[model samples]
Target: MKTMRFTPPGYGGRRRDPEQVKRDGWREQGILAVSVDDERLTWPERELVRQLGDRLYGPRAADDGGRHG
Candidate 1:
């Protein structure tokens, strides 16, 4: 036999997309947290972010420092 669990409202424990969260924060509250070129990330990490950004949100502008952000 299996037991059912009760989940509370707004507490479903759903994992959010970090990238979307960052974008939302920037768009809704003008908060630019953890950019692709924040200098804190390594080259590979930056490149991964850049690639994901490009794939998800299209390519970045040419004047945006080669889409490093």
Candidate 2:
């Protein structure tokens, strides 16, 4: 959606697809991924959060930064 601009939805009765993805070519049978406002925050934002966590907590002694709050 960011690469190209789109017209307002339902302006001319053109609507979005019900299923975001098709399982035709995909090998995985059951996988659902939902993206919200995808244009915001790239990988750097996630990395920055990781770096800040390390800096504030000193590399997380034994934890591998896996647990989610």
Candidate 3:
């Protein structure tokens, strides 16, 4: 299995690059297409997608240590 890593562009407190954002969006669209065609995800792939979603849209609480001042 191939490994994939997702990093938000310019994630370390820098402005994101528009080209990188477009590339990432394309990658995400590809994943969505595959998921739709396959109709089900393998366990590991499912977990990876879940984690990615969390990174993208998860809740942030004060005690989670991810809150911005």
Where is model 1 more than 4 Å wrong at Cα?
1-33, 63-69
Global lDDT scores for all candidate models: 0.79, 0.51, 0.57
Model 2, residue 35: C-alpha shift (Å): 16
Tens digit per residue, CA lDDT, model 2, 1-69: 355356566566644464535342233666433222234547776556556667866665445658755
Query: lDDT at 67 for candidate 3?
Result: 62
Q: Which wins on TM-score, candidate 2 or candidate 3?
A: 3
Per-residue C-alpha lDDT of model 1 across residues 30-61, encoded as one tens digit per residue: 97666777687999988888888888788778
Ranking by TM-score: 1, 3, 2
Error of 3 at 45 (Å): 0.3
lDDT of 3 by residue, 1-69 (tens): 976476667555566686566667778775342231233677787667656655876833532567667
Question: Of models 2 and 3, which has the larger lDDT?
Answer: 3
Q: List the residue pairs that clash in candidate 3.
A: none
In model 3, which runs have C-alpha deviations exceeding 4 angstroms?
A: 1-39, 59-69
Clashes of each: 0, 0, 0
Better of 1 and 3 by lDDT: 1
